[model samples]
Target: MKNRIRDLRTAKGMTQEDLAEIIGVSRQTINAIEKEKFDPSLPTAFKMAQLFELPIEQIFLFEI
Candidate 1:
């Protein structure tokens, strides 16, 4: 899986910490997601989509 979290967050002028707070996750979790080392749960994905006003598919891309 790959994600546009880092790009989106930065484009929104939010730091990892800021995004984490809004999404109700740890900053490290946000970092991990941005690094593609972690995949967020459905709820978390939904939160991100809501925050960004985009579809989950737009943020996270599944190659397989």
Candidate 2:
């Protein structure tokens, strides 16, 4: 899985800490997600989609 989390967060002027605070995760978790070392849970993905006003598919890309 790949994600636009860093791009989106930077675009919104949010630090990993900020995003993590809003999404109820650790900053390291956000970093991991951005680095593609971790895939967020469905609920976390939904929160990100809602926060970014984008669809889940737009934020996270799953390659077949």
Best by TM-score: 2
Any runs in candidate 1 off by more than 4 Å, and if so which? none
Query: lDDT tens string, model 2, 1-64?
Result: 9899999999999999999999999999999999999999999999999999999999999997
lDDT of 1 by residue, 1-64 (tens): 8999999999999999999999999999999999999999999999999999999999999998
State the displacement of the C-alpha of residue 44, model 1, in Å, after optimal TM-score superposition.
0.2
Name the TM-score of candidate 2. 0.98
TM-score per candidate, in order?
A: 0.97, 0.98
Model 2 Cα shift for residue 49 (angstroms): 0.1
The residue-level lDDT of candidate 2 at 19 comes to: 98
After superposing candidate 2, which stretches have Cα over 4 Å from the reference? none
